[model samples]
Target: MGAETNGNLEFLSKIPEIKFTKLFINGEFVDSVSGKTFETIDPRTGEVIAGVAEGDKEDVDLAVKAARHAFDHGPWPRLPGTARRKILLKFADLIDEHAEELAALESIDAGKLFGWGKAVEIPGTAENVRYYAGAADKIHGETLKMSSAHQGYTLREPIGVVGHIIPWNFPSTMFLLKVSPALAAGCTMVVKPAEQTPLNALYFAHLAKLAGIPDGVLNVITGYGTTAGAAISSHMDIDKISFTGSTEVGRLILQAAATSNLKAVTLELGGKSPLIIFDDADVDQAAELALLGNLFNKGEICVAASRVFVQEGIYDQLVKKLAEKAKTWTVGDPFDPKVDKEQYDKVLSYIEHGKREGATLLTGGKPCGAKGYFIEPTVFTDVKDNMMIAKDEIFGPVMSLMKFKTVEEAIQRANATRYGLAAGVLTKDINVANTVSRSIRAGTIWINTYFAFDKDAPFGGYKMSGFGRDLGAQGLEQYLQVKSVVTPIYNSPWL
Candidate 1:
């Protein structure tokens, strides 16, 4: 390590060492039944950070059993809403206290920028927890009056044991996206964190326990998706499964749930999100949004605006500005207080495909640094709708630029993809913004900004991108089941 890298690592070493690498079950850290473990490699240096227990079918069963017990009989699910809120608030506070430790773990394990991981991802996660904590006591059912000689009402109750299969990218955010709402809804859970980034989730489980979340209310199992993930999906006792990953894997999870007990499944899958810039929009602002939309988090975001559509009038100007701006983004170590091998290879391959397929490589198109999985921020112009780069989700720091002549054509081109997770429009004209915003088929659309995520807004995708919302009251409902109660009016003699 260089002097600077050593200084960064030294700062991280001051925090407490991670002691929760093993599987957490019923509030205790224990070895997997099979005694099998997997090495977690740091993408920056290709070094083994830690050996995490590999949870499989047997381990999943144990976790499910514990979650079921917690739901059916433990104090956690039976606590009052105010009580749950208190515990969750405390949990959020504890996460804030250990923000540096959590952020460091995420950076080394997932190759996310240490500063961004600490400042953005970790803090955002804590905010998500606080949002859900405040929302816990606010959740309520409904009352109704029947026309007939009967009175009726509906009740929303916790959907017992929930299974959360989290994705590797944005591990901290995704974990809270699945767990916080379930916590608010009085449901116990079995979480299977992606093998590549399991440290933060295990550490979060410890925080939950410290916050007085009872035994069996939360369990973290670290393993590959096929074994632990498959077991969770097919477990009969699990009331629901919420997953965030690739569309292909989302389909498999759906099949597993259907063939098993038909557990409720909510998925937030792949995206090839488009950022449309019209002629009337500010060219500088449009260029910056386009750059951030694709380059943030090294372009590992699920809703990354990879497919950029520019109106013909401003096409050349915006493309040139974005190309210039793309050169400024630094890519290297994720923990030098800053910023994959398979993922690296995949992104480089896409850049090559962009060149071979006839898209103009306007800027960067090669790897950076002598080592590590670093790719230069790349921009491609003259991209056609039929090109592979435009059609596929190249989850990297690559931007593909295409053009449309009119508003109608822009909307059509934006909605052409099977993936409709998110789309962005840059226009100062209210009429144009309104028309395009409503016309686009994406689950979330940004009018002026590219990515403006908040806990209050509900977010998901349409078509092949998957279903269900992950934030706000809509998210809490995912962990609840609704039922109706009826009472006959004796005086009215109605049955």
Candidate 2:
């Protein structure tokens, strides 16, 4: 460990101080009620970055109480939409102003690349905040056309206290994705940032206060999922919950919500997405896209194209192109942003399983560096439909490449797995694109491209991948409740 992290030394110089480690409740940074703490490890050096407050059931309860009070009796809900919008705009401005610090913190905490965090993640988070802030004043309900002789309308009101359980990958992005819409909808929330990467969320809480958000409106509790997350899911005061993580955890949240006050739940769960490259597609471009789809975010993406199906004619050519394009992907941050040790071991284990299951390793099946949890970009060829690597959501930089003779076969194999989160179809023919994209059983399908996410476009998963959306006007729908109001006219039939 002594000399293995020399690459990180220069980058470490720019890392921001690890401040705001305590639980953020009622607009104040405070320790957990139980006074316990957990270590947040830096993935690059395998070193403890800082000790953060470990929120348990008691902490979650306090967060819930504060959020409930804010929603029920505070000014956030009663304030005009424009007023809320103004505050949120200021919040976005603050995020933009501190983009560098936030990016550095993400790098130190989550092993995320500083450049990408600075250029894309940080600014993109601010953009989403602004997007939702603009929509704060535009939430509208339709004037109902009643069948009877009466006047009727619908009011879209904020759903009470909400619980947002964000995943570690892309913490800031997911933060804005869930919190911004709820904030715009005038709903108070208790947030449980993933324990592995909780620093950014805590920093976000600090920024929220600086932007003049009312006390108790947005509270963040950093702790393990079994305790804090489970408490949030089952808390009676929390009217709704939005979670992004594994399907296994998602089911637990659903059960907790059902067993409690029957809180609304929105889950954006895991995926074993497929990228289909047809014979008619551009070989080089498709290969590059396949690399991008598999390795983007170090292959930690929930929507990663871990399964790649290539047509029979161009399979060999595209495979070579894919390996060639993979060369450019090697350049990035010093340590790839793996969440923690478990993930690193898990990725290595998946690679081992891929080899044992008869899938041929095309390239990169081992660890990258001596120290840090870095798995090399791995690709396996001749992957069968039934193999674990092909079916399971490995959540790593491992790709399973297979060959299909026809479009029907490709589509069949793409939708073979239990996941229906996302998929990519690469084809020059419009008819093929239309047919394949429509046939795949996924919530979002990209044609000739991958990861085309936007703030205006709603995103979610299908089947076991979970329900509800996280962006666009629909993203805010989960945070709001619709109530119908009707009044009979003087000449109504009832009168």
Candidate 3:
């Protein structure tokens, strides 16, 4: 089933209505095995917008069974790479065609601003699909030189059924991130979306079918993480599990995978990344990049620059200018045409936490208005490295600015966190940038810019942020298994 037409923009004067409430299994909307459903509320207003199917262990079993059956005996795995590429390209085209409707549903479901959702996230999803679609036909195998009198070669094959668990912050993007590559690699999948934001995932499953994805090749299961998520992690038939969420849950998934069939696991977990600004750096440019890096998506980003380490020479000036610019950011109802609501409330909540945790509120710490989940853009200065705001992943629009005396100190402080997901450095000194980039430990690093992503680049983490890359050629490798083949060229006398 598709989104209900009741919530069309023309009907905005009326109350928002439920658009979807079923799980997608085997290419159709179906009920959970236990017949239980959970309410998906709009975080902005704390109102229930729809009730989604609550899948339990039983449902996970069915989904895994479907995926396994498809992998073992379906046309998806047997199809040529060119054939898969054609279908995936068609899917990407469909995503673009319905971009507006999908963006609206995502905004209403996850409390993101409609404009940003439409302009950025939806298009990013389509790009990811198309990238993998083209890459599908390019996966290759290599020949190996034999030490003995035998010819040998390696074949890259689909790993089999995959289980993907996505987070709430970027439901649509993460869905495409995990599903597209798996499909391109000829593996079927079952997805378990976060309970807080499940609607977009269900809608995507419908779009997948519309794009001609086979039944049982893709499924969406919605339920509490402890039940459905845990079941997927521990399923024996699931050949792989790709997760994007917290580090704690990533650990649990690792344990579950180890305890079950030893499925291959790839995790894109938490981050408290750092942004370093040198004395010679351009203040205006640095300030803008810092704001976008930390405040994008309301700072609900895993790779957000939560920690800002500025060289002492420019620290005070950058901090002041940043705080000043932050005050001008509009925070109000996400649906309001004038404001960016996606990150407003989340930013405000982090501001509140900063105060409670005794962080020195530099500026912009209060909500701007009375309606919606709006919070003033906030920055904390004189934040010690040990402070909670500095150490933890405050996935909101709160930035912590700390001063560093040297390049060594900046690299030391940047690498101090358990997370090594992403870090940014702003400097005109090419030598300094190269030195610091090598010193700091993170999966991705930005120089003078932040949040730069492309399908050709591999995305992931280095430490507690979790392992395995998400995009590029390496991303496709995550869904493949390498097998070596050898043949004897001469008959043996012993035989």
Candidate 4:
């Protein structure tokens, strides 16, 4: 197949050649125990970029051993909080130094927008590292005054080896989200990057070593989720598992952890989040936020506002502006080539589902170029609550618009879905914002903007979206085990 590079991709010449492509273990890059390898394709060009090691059960066991050793006896966990913080700061600086390479790797490996990869994902990842570095020494425990007979306190200790099963959509961001906090919490981890996008994780392993993290502190395994992921979830030696993926896979991981060591687990799963635009809001601003809410990252986001509710008073004007904005989007070649065929087909299928379910096609409904995986940015109007496109989590650039009469109706319709990951409300009325935000059952509620993520904000979902927060102080708790300590002020009679 012939691949078309977007606008000649002059920047591609600046990307350094990729070198490392193997399972990272014990501060070294090595092949799988079975001596097997698999091809990692560039989603943009749909061509083989490199042959990555195919890690299996044997590889997972070895990684777990490395992590277990690090947690139990290695220098990383034993290091002073200040020392750990210094090393993590160095790691973040190194990432900043190599931001271009990491961004290029992510763009090539995952079909992320080139500008977004270079300007947003890479810098944001480093920010996460730096933010958590500041928290390394701040993992505080409580000093309590109990009954006078005893002095009682608590300790927040590391939970030992952790398994991080990363997702493909936001590879670098997701990696940092799990790894940074775990590192800050003094936990060693075995990371299984998604097979579809393993390049950046391996690159990061090299950076971690350069930043002076000890051997076995971080191990990355690349392979099919069934073999390597299963081993990690069920590994008896691993103390906890942090996963970001679909609800189906999250359930399987929960079961595996339950049946094996009953290890601690935190999941960031699927979502069908909603965005509500009231009549009182600025129509133009609402249209812009609505577009960003649904189409950012090609709508592959877990918290994407795929279900949009516009107040009936301004529904027609908002839909018109949204459609016009959708048409203006440059819909080809995310990095240099287009999106991968798999995702392209998936988005197209959802567009077709919208048509079949009686949703009016607003502006776009077709693929872009003939050469690469490019789908036109799509919008739909007159969507009903029960439509498949309205309810299902279509992780693509397709927006479903529906009309609502009142704020109560919007809140009720938004909360009707099984998911509760995130929601956005656009309104000038402070009461409307407060009331609707309070009523909507979502982990995060955006008052006027959309997709505003910060290191200090805790992010997660209720209902089927998943449990456990991923950022902020709550995120660090995921890798920590709380223990109460009690000591007598004087010698007891029994003693």
Best by lDDT: 2
Return whichever of 3 and 4 wins on TM-score: 4
| lDDT, residue 435, model 3 | 98
Q: Which residues of candidate 3, in runs, are more than 4 Å off?
A: 1-18, 337-353, 356-358, 367-371, 491-495
**1-495 per-residue lDDT for model 1 (tens digits):** 599788877766744476779999999999999999999877777777889999999999999999999899898877889999999999999999988888888888888777777787898898898888888887677888889888889888998899999988888989998999999999999999988889999999999999999999999999999899999999999989999989999999999999999999999999999999999999999999999999888888889999989998999898778877877877766655112578889999989998999999999998877666778889999899998999988888889999898999998989999999999999889999999999999999999997899888999999999999899789998998999999988877555
Q: Tell me the TM-score of each prediction against the true structure.
A: 0.96, 0.97, 0.93, 0.96
Any runs in candidate 4 off by more than 4 Å, and if so which?
Answer: 1-9, 335-339, 491-495
Question: Candidate 4's residue-wise lDDT over 354-415, tens digit each?
Answer: 89989999988897665656677788999999999998888888889999998889988999
- The lDDT, on a scale of 0 to 1, for candidate 2 is 0.90
Candidate 3 versus truth, CA RMSD in Å, comes to 4.4
Q: Candidate 2: TM-score?
A: 0.97
Error of 3 at 305 (Å): 0.6
Judged by TM-score relative to the true structure, which candidate is superior, 2 or 3?
2
lDDT per residue for candidate 3 within 1-495, as digits (tens), equals: 135454444435323445667888888888998889998766556566777889999988888888888889999988999999998998888888878777777777776777777787798899899999998887778898887778789999999999999998888999999999999999999999988888888878888888888899999999989999999999999999999999999999999999989999999999999999999999999999888887787778899988999999998899889978887777654555111244454455566767877778887777644554656567899888887788888777788999999998899889988999999999999999999999888999999889998888899999999999999989999999999999886875533
RMSD in angstroms, all models? 1.9, 2.2, 4.4, 2.5
lDDT, candidate 4, residue 203? Answer: 94
Q: Model 1: which ten-residue window has the lowest total lDDT?
A: 331-340
Q: lDDT tens digits, residues 1-495, model 2? A: 766577558566778898899999999999999899999988887989999999999999998889889988999999899999999999999999999999988887887888888888899999999998998898888898887878899999999999999998888899889999999999999999999999999999999999999999999999999999999999988899999999999999999999999989999999999999988888988888898899988898999999999999999998888777776667335423555899988888889998999999988888776677777788899999999999889988889999999888888889888899999999889999999888998999999889999988899999999999989889988899999999988866676
- Give candidate 2's error at residue 312 in angstroms: 0.5
